[model samples]
Target: MGAPESLSLLNPARHAGGVFVNGEWQRPRGGSRVVTEPATGLELAASAVANAEDMREAIAQAHAAQRAWAATNPRERAAVLLRAAEGLQAHFDELALAIARETGGILAKGQHEVREAIVICQIAAGLPLQAQGQVLPATPGRLSIARRVPHGVIGVISPFNFPLILGIRSVAPALALGNAVVLKPDTRTPVTGGAIMAEIFQRAGLPSGLLQMLPGDAEAGEALVTDSRVPMIAFTGSPAVGRRIGELAGRHLKKVSLELGGANNLVILDDADLDAAASAAAFGAWFHQGQICMASNRVLVHEKIADALKARLVAKAGYLPVGDGASGQVALGPMIDNKQLQRFNALVHETVAQGATLEAGGSHTGLCYQPTVLSGVKPGMRSFDDEPFGPLVNLVTFSTDDEAVALANNSQGGLSAAVISHDVGRALALGERLNAGMVHINDQTVNDECTNPFGGPGLGGNGSAVGGPADIDEYTRWQWLTVKAALPAFPF
Candidate 1:
């Protein structure tokens, strides 16, 4: 693929990677990280690798903004979000291209993420209209009601994959409900994770200091989570890091929302349509090069249909081309960086060494590992027991329906599961038994929409209000209010 004909350099200031605090770009005090394009390993830009001192300054600014923004009219706040969506759409090209370059996603995938973000903004704009609390029956001459209130500043730590979508998914709702935010985009994809929003909202009339974009590494993340002024935190990343954040949250007793890792499973029964099952596997296992946390990590097929399903999946996967996402026609893109590329390769080698047959693509060049499929894999191997965030899928054979459900629930991180069968009732029934937050009947595991209950159970997520419109309350607190027509008789 050639450089996108429509793509051009972003504003020099944005590419320079200044942190946005108090509504303006903050130059690096000294240290910085050179962000390189993952697919090609070419220098894209230098982003500030902010330290604790820088983070403290950003947090202080966010607290001040939260207080001021809380006083603004909710209706006005909603209007700003709508306009921000407009801003995102208007600048779609630059934002999409940057996502492809930094994150190693194909152009189509980048465009898809941007679309989800636009809808998130549009939907979140209506959140203010729901702020009216329900009145409750009270003692005579008194009224009682519960009202949602913002929790000052929210510390948002986002990941590299789907940077824009995940970043805005948490950001839009927080802002809509009057909370200030200090966002720490992944060091791997600072521009899409931080700068894009900074630019979009700067033009969309959001007050200065309300949204701070800090492009930094784990050190900065530590600073954000420990900062008492922020009061609350939302994080989407690996479970190991999530646990560390959890420890800090407990230490401070701050509110936290965690969307963590998954070792998702896809199950196919003997009565299932092999064609549909194969197609679902290809889409769910290889999309984004299998970087999604909810990716189809393993396929469990009933022994009666395992061979046929394997053949169909290999054929379907062969038809899908692989290359740089900037080529505009790519499906599977490169791993985010060489480290991820190496980790992906290591998992594949380990799986085969554990007696699993290398049944499909396994060769690689640079960061582009082909979509892979393995058969006869079982428990104990990292490929079988752990989540590998790359385009690799392992096959396992199951006997009874009970066995299938048991295999699907084998992982500690059960985020999503899919059951495919001809009998809808059987599929639905199996779906109910799977240990996942989301189960897809007659489909695959990788699907997600803007308006669903998106988090999983166990270490998969903390379930602090995300996924649906009901999540508007995740970034908010509740307060009870009461009034009396006249002073009620005081009871001492």
Candidate 2:
């Protein structure tokens, strides 16, 4: 289904071109791509793809705008973010519908994403008021200070899943910290990811050129990463793509933050409540059809209770509704596209062929795949070793707590992990050793808060943090200032 008329800017004719740069929407130099609804295979909009030249212009415009923006007082910048948060809240329903229509997420999921984004906006609105520097001890008759400063222009490359949250989390904070942003959302969900932000900020009375939205493919993304004018880049996507961006940005000597892929695990200990653990696994593993980076790719259960938990997961998986989520009739929606569906199928089939038993759902009509479960999964299987962004959960049994930790930390990713146990102390202790960025005890892996530092090491992120005070380091640099009443006498 198409987006509501309130989101008409997604229409190519209304946008008048695909890119939003400098203060207005304009045509890009690159070719066009059709944005389709994965749930229905219907054309949602035709977005103008931005080529390298278009990206260059956007970066230059952002650089030009950033100087003046950074010169503004902290309160002024914070006020704009506060207003943007209100604007986002005002259009909550429309934004939620656009997310559902553009990304095939269920309406509830869309609403949740919008609400999270609004919270992020609200949190970011207060960033400017935070201490931006420190007083340094100096010699007598001298004053010294170190102040945080903006990085000028920041380039953000966001993925399709949870686009609004990912995009806003970076954009709002960057702008609040007095930096201009050039956002290149994944072309698949540009309306909800890019255009909506532009409309919200513009209505919130943001100055022109502070935020540029260019929805495009790899060529444009590379242009943003390699451009000399854009000194920092924030990317959220697959490990493969994040690596590419990291390498390129490193070569350019630019600061980059990456929130990449994960093979997150939900470890169910022997003493865990089977019903609660099973419900958590189902939601963590299959939410958003498992497209999320934090989605539980593997469910590791204690061998003592593996069979019981598996049965509950099988029963739950069998009953979850799967269909077009845009119709508001399903808990799980279609895969982002057929290409992703093919990949999910290949991984699941290969894992099953490797001797894992198909315990529950394992079929699909169109892009809506069943929430398949695999039992007897081993480390060598694709389902356990690879990051399959689909509705499939690999069930592996661990003999001891140490074995559970080893299995959970087996993957290259260190993004998120969850531990379920009746004993809170044991769960917390186990979680601390799991090598993940964020750990939830007695909860699922998929969790986020505006104030939480949201990133991991290794394949997950590149030593940079996001959210709350982390923005102070990610979006700005430091400048030292010293003054003396008179020139100190030197040997002459």
Question: Where's the lowest-lDDT run of ten residues in candidate 1?
Answer: 1-10
In the range 1-492, model 2's lDDT, one tens digit per residue, is 233567543345656347899879887889678888888888888776899999999998898889999989888888888888777777777778889978889999988888888888888888889988999999888999999989889999999999999999999999999999999998888888898888888878899999999999999999999999999999999888999999999999999999986678899999998888899999999999999888998899999999999889888887889988877888899888889899999999999999999998778999889999999999989989888899988999999899999988897866899999999999999999987888899999999878989998786777567997688888899999999998989999
* Runs off by more than 4 Å, candidate 2: 1-12
lDDT of each: 0.84, 0.88
lDDT of 2 at 181: 98
Q: What's the lDDT for residue 111 in model 2?
A: 89
Q: Can you give the lDDT of residue 411 in candidate 1?
A: 79
Q: What digit string (tens of lDDT, one per residue) describes model 1 on residues 295-334?
A: 9988899999899988987876677778788878777888
List TM-scores for all candidates, in order. 0.95, 0.97
User: What is the TM-score of candidate 1?
Assistant: 0.95
Candidate RMSDs in order: 2.5, 2.1
lDDT value for model 2: 0.88
